[model samples]
Target chain A: MDIDLILKAINITVIGYIIVFVVLFLLYLSFYYLAKLLESQAKERCRRAGKNKCAEHDKFSVDSDTTAAIAMALYLHFGETHDIDSTKLTMKRESKRYTPWNSKIYNVIHRL
Target chain B: MEGLYRFLEYTGFANFTFGHGIMIIVGLVFIFLAIKKDYEPLLLVPIGFGIILGNIPFIQNAGLNLGVYENGSVLRYLYFGVLSGVYPPLIFLGIGAMTDFSTLISNPKLMLLGAAAQLGIFATFLGSIFLGFNLNEAGAIGIIGGADGPTAIFLASKLANGSNGNLNLIGPIAIAAYSYMALVPVIQPPIMRLLTTKKERVIRMKPPRSVSKVEKIIFPVAGLLLTGFISPASLPLLGMLFFGNLLKESMVTERLAETARKPMIDIVTILLGLTVGASTQADIFLTKQSVLIFILGALSFMVATAGGILFAKFMNLFLSNENKINPLIGSAGVSAVPDSARVSQLEGLKYDKNNHLLMHAMAPNVAGVIGSAIAAGILMSFLL
Candidate 1:
């Protein structure tokens, strides 16, 4: 019931909220700029790769068989090691059962 | 006849009060909500059962030693984890292990929204002060605004009650915090709808840029140092949180991280929930102050949700059209984590089924945890 303590708490609230906001705002600024930098770097890499491909074509134009062989190699490498078309990953149940937890219980019963 | 009378008086039937009956009913209601309504079953089931066990009255300092208040009792040992503020940090460690901070790192501006949501904590502190709770008590009550049950319990354990059992507000404050956290789905969506337009809800944000592993690893360390310098009092909570994140992100400590998130969290939760429930003896719990704390807790959640949305809307004024935020994601800035984020996703889907806000909402959701811990540290610095 101390008035002084209550006044102190009010002070803490003001100072505290201000400090929290400033710290987070600074974090936001740093992160925002970091993301921007990353985005630009990614674009730079893509552009460089595009230019390098053009340079390769200009320097030594591969014949039809050579191009076919390179394409086949790429297709094989990608087919074995990569997810071609780079689709967005999803998380959901695509089951006929409308409710999963309930449906699974019935399935357990039937299985048994 | 005197011996028989004494034995009868010692029986649970003789010791049981009407308050205990009411508490049992309240506990049943919680259980029902957990089972039928599917409301935070992981938390509620243990807590509800503990409430039942706690209210089964016995003689004071009996040989059975079943009471949470009794010294050398098993439940008391578990309850000590709460009173000593041990379990929450451990819970934070588990939380950090499970959390993917890439979302927050990818869009750190949303971290500001999390900070903005903490306005509710301070607002409720003032309300609690006006309602005649002491500064310590008010601070504990205020943290419910963070919508983080463990932080609320941790802070309240340290602040609301003294080292000895004088003026215990931990029961009320912890319950209010967890109750409000569990009700995030019901409480947040209407406020979100009220604040934002359908057009705003349907707005799609650009996919967040993939964060590098190095950045993810650096985040926890840098975040700890930044927060530690600002609020050293929060180190116990933040240290564990960031440490757990490091364990997960480092990839080398996969076993330690896996155990911390799953088994470790589950075990601590059971102990923490049960102990917290048992602490709520009707006499200690059903006070005028307890009622005020619950009222303030609900108000705190509303204001915190509003604060985040308003801040996001304010930020939108300066933002380009493509850079603008969906105000629904603002509610996720409260520290209820995936639930609040899920609520945002549900709201977004209601407007546009193809709209998926979960990943975007997660940025603020995780940041809200950090924000609340920092707020707690701030309160500790001032009050403790």
Candidate 2:
């Protein structure tokens, strides 16, 4: 019950609280910077893909189901958005000239 | 009658004491928990068996030299493996191989949440120092905040050396950390619910896009360089972790990666568990301080989770409505890996079934492993 000891304990506790706040503040700033960087990168990738010219447009929309499934897998694997135009173009080119059911019509289709 | 008496005496039943009986019962319970409940069966089963074997009176013949006269015993050597900071890092390497870092790279911002979660480590460190532990002991005790078993053991072995040569503290610390990790589902939800309203919990994060393979390969290497430069003591654990990860991503060392992920890790876990549990003899484990350590471990975990969540809430003030993070994922920053992340996801799903926070949360979840290791390294350099 020494008054001096009690005061010392209070001082230590206050210091500890202050330190926690400081560390937490630093952590907040680090995350803010990281998130800002990620957002900018996402926008840049979208631009490179010829989707939205700027951040204020919706040039990269996909159907809901396809978006959900592909989004999850792509994010898990790549950590960034897929280039929408390239993927779609690849799919279209593959389907038209090489449809599986029309294998026998391939020569005629190629001529056409 | 004489033959029967002779057989009983030879088996040491005639000389059985209360301590021996208690240890046997404890071992039996450990066996039951392992076999029936499957509670960490790989290590628990061996440890249970080792405890029973070590406790058998006069098994002094079977390496039970208790050194009634000396301060140390044979069990001391077996326990030394855990105390030297060997097995746990090897176990970490295995974990690194098995883990999928794609979730983390896909959402790098979550790494901040992981770093925020380490607030518990520093808080507990100060608490322990105020409680009369020296710098080293405080460092060891604080890592319980990381919620990682190997790191706890590694730090404890480093701290609890010298004058307090009692390396036995590692066992309790590790067991407590791993136990709380398994209880994440139970311990985290209420805290998550209380801190975050239903609407906040259910907030949906926009899915991140695909990351390139080059990015994946670069992420761990860059992380190691950055964190290691800041805190070199973290090199042993973090370096090995990223190395194992690099092996997996590089895709050339399929055999080495496969080995690291399974049998190599399994073997180390068994050895590590038995060695750790064997150190918990009745004389050492049954103490007031031991109980305090367990309680403190739980407190550290709670504080770490709270710190992460609160930090996220603070961030919400600045972020646009769409960019504000779901604070539930903040809890995953304690280095328990996918368990803490899964807990965050579950809490998020409870509020919004359509909301998926697992992948996003995983970024912080994985970053926590590195953060805690850096914290440990800093402590090691300062204290040791």
Candidate 1's TM-score reads 0.85
**Poorest stretch of ten by lDDT in candidate 1 chain B:** B160-169
True contacts kept of each: 0.53, 0.03
True-structure lDDT of candidate 2: 0.71
lDDT of 2 by residue, B217-263 (tens): 77667767766666678888988898888878888898898999899
TM-score of each: 0.85, 0.74
Against the true structure, whose lDDT is highest? 1
* Candidate 1 residue B210 C-alpha distance from true site, Å: 1.2
Provide chain B's TM-score, model 2.
0.88
DockQ of 1: 0.21
lDDT of 2 at B138: 66
